[model samples]
Target: MGNAGRNAVVLVVTKVADATADLVIEQLNARRIPIVRLDPGDFPTSVAVNAYLGNHGLSGSLRTPSRIADLRGIRSVYWRRPSPYSVADDMRPQDAHWCADQARYGLGGLLGALPDAHYVNHPWRNRDAEHKPAQLAVAARCGLDVPPTLVTNDAERARWFARECGPVVYKPVRNTDYHGDDSRALTVWVEEVAPSEIDTEVGRTAHLFQQRVDKVADIRLTAVGDQLFAVRIDGAPGLDWRRDYDALSYTLIETPPEVAKAVRAYLDAFGLVFGAFDFGLDRHGRWWMYECNPNGQWAWFPDPITERITAALADRLQSPGNAHAR
Candidate 1:
């Protein structure tokens, strides 16, 4: 709390057990910067927010166990993943549903409108950038190479596109919570799809099919403010490197000039200050755009790289003026 009386506070919005947020918080703590970390989902239970609109605008105080954050005095906000708002299960289902919606729009709206506080990535922008179709379109427009892709709910169209694209892969446009019959969590991994394998079941919902690149490796480039950290991930024996963490190797690498420029443009197009971009490095040394995760995780990488990213984020949170606001 050194000089905290003179310094503006940073509000970290995330769940209690977030390792990524923990890293940044540790860095800020070492700097003696004041931070109020709270999950909005804890409202009415462990957290409280009081806001009022007056002559100046919306201003209030958010109270947690050990700290209280002044809405107007917050210099920056690190909006990470927060748990969903919940109420007691003993209440009627209909009443609980209504209460949850109210809390979402009420407390959620207040957090989204923190009056001049810099957001690592504003939640609204994150929502807009999360769509895979929009991401591919923007990346291509920014001069980045994009594979031939098709999103369809028609069985014939899917098969036709798959045949035309030669080697195609099927992946979920966005990962959503899914559970098996036993109530265990399930993941839909990216896999090669043959035209014949696709059937009327594909028509049940929209599916994304992309021309699979003859990739030799994968690149995960994390951007913080104006800084970019590119890491080459090798030895992943499957289409998605995320499927196996222990089998992968990481090497810090320099970003290609063209790819770097296009990435910056893509970020600007979506008004995002931070993004984690995934690219496929083909045998020809070409980088193909996969997707850009606005609120993606980055703290899992090896030593020096993770340290650098954490420091950059801490720096951005400390100096809100250095971040661009849409």
Candidate 2:
């Protein structure tokens, strides 16, 4: 290995108590890789960064309580789930906003500009793949089977689609947490809807209505680099498999070659090295793509799947050139 490769470090961006990050970091540690794990939520306070333009390119140091990471020496960055930056409560609202912007564009921007550093999946690319409509379109374009989807804000159109499509499902454009009357947080679950349920209120905002696929099982495919780990999830009949994790049973299975090819193609289209794809496996043995989460959760999965994913990620971080080769 060259000097740069010898001195390279792996930067992990994630919040505390993230089991997924913990596993990956554990693997990296076993491989004797230098790592700097920092949560940006403590930025401008506990976490400090100083970057400057130099002859080599963007160079900086990220300082936390225990250690400091040399920005220039970062070969691969695992952009896992990091909490949002928090500002001082005593600061004015406007001042806090300004400070947050600086932290984002300044420190965040410098990290984004690192030379030859591979981000597992770039943050901007992650944001782009998060769009359900865009993901459907891309999956379809990649020759993956996708269910008919309609995004509209017109009640008449929604009703027409619902009537034409035998069984349609209503899903939020983006899942969000809402407080109930009792101040308890609740998440909106995907539910099958009828034509009669279409109301004028749907016209108030854009909504997603898709023809529900007659699926016997759900598939969760976690892609790390070019490798895809598929798990067949069998559970109670429901519009959303995520409604109850406890009710689900998982089995590791090989992904069909054609579908796997489409998955790799979809990742290329999104410029992502990693993605978590959900699919509906129909009773007729057809697989239909739903969406891909660029920064999705994978640790809770069972058996060899989680272990395989953790190793794949650690390998990618340990050898980033393989990611580009894929």
Candidate 3:
């Protein structure tokens, strides 16, 4: 809901009452940015294909724009993590598909409709933005060393790659919709996959296989505009660092000039102004591109991370010259 006269920023997040996004919301408020949160689950089952916000202010919300005496005034938008919902919990697959699809594409369009409001990362662009294979290609084009990779559904081919490479890793082709208790599911870390385990029957579904690189460290590159910052995560054991966040140690590190240049190109390739990229630094310290998450979480990271992102976003959103055109 827009306050008729107040400059309100709307944030669409699930479980708005809890979660880390709430902390970001608090920070926004501390900066005196008026915010209104909407849970997608609470929205109408269907919506128009076009965006609906007006310069006059937001309407049809928990608060009334006219009564609140507010004008349409959201200066920027941060597409943080979106909340989750299940149509299977109640509706049929087809019905659920339509509902979720419309909400995602539609709600995103509405936010994009905001006059002159800057988006941290646009959704339409994010759709095809981060495929692992595509990222690898981009990394190579930018002169970054990309590890040998194989994506297949054939058991024989997968096994052959494993046997040829000895120690290899297997993971999903894209991000899965499972989290919370399933944090383990987010791992794309390297592990030895024996060739014997390959079911000549793997033709059932497509799986990703990659040659494992012995890593001496990991790096998380957070890019905001032209500003590139990387943190070297040292001494993290196990294939997935996310599995043991508590034990991981971090040190601010400078990326190679070429690597930094490549990171910017990778984000620009996706039309993204922000991203959190994961890389496996080989035993020789050569960086191997894993994936770039357009909406990856970083609030839990170090203070410099928070300061860089928050300041960059604020500058873009509050710029007097970036106003939306009617």
| Best lDDT among the predictions, by candidate number | 1
Q: Lowest summed-lDDT stretch of 10 residues in model 1?
A: 1-10
Whole-model lDDT per candidate: 0.90, 0.87, 0.66
lDDT of 1 at 38: 81
Q: Tens-digit lDDT track for model 3 on 119-233?
A: 6676555666767787778778877777788889888889899988868988778866555684654435445689988886678777888887788888998777777778888
Model 1 clash pairs are none
Name the better of 1 and 3 by TM-score. 1
> Clash pairs of candidate 2?
none
The lDDT, on a scale of 0 to 1, for candidate 3 is: 0.66
Quote the positional error of residue 188 for candidate 2 in Å. 0.8
The TM-score obtained by model 1 is: 0.96
- Write model 2 residue lDDT over 1-326, tens digit each, in one string: 22157878888988997888999999999999989898888887898888878675676688988878777688888898888878899999999999889888877777677777888878778888899999999999998999999999999999999999859999898877799999999988888899999999997888999999999999999998778899999985687878788999999999999998999999999999999998999999999988888999999898577999999999998988755643
The predictions' CA RMSDs to the true structure, in order, are: 2.0, 1.6, 5.2
lDDT of 1 by residue, 1-326 (tens): 22123567998999999999999999999999989998978887888889999887888888999898888888888999898898877989999999899999999899888887888888889999999999999999999999999999998999998898869999898999899999999999999999999999988888999999999999999998778999999999989999989999999999989988999999999999899999999999999989999999999999799999999999998986755654
TM for every model, in the order presented, reads: 0.96, 0.96, 0.78
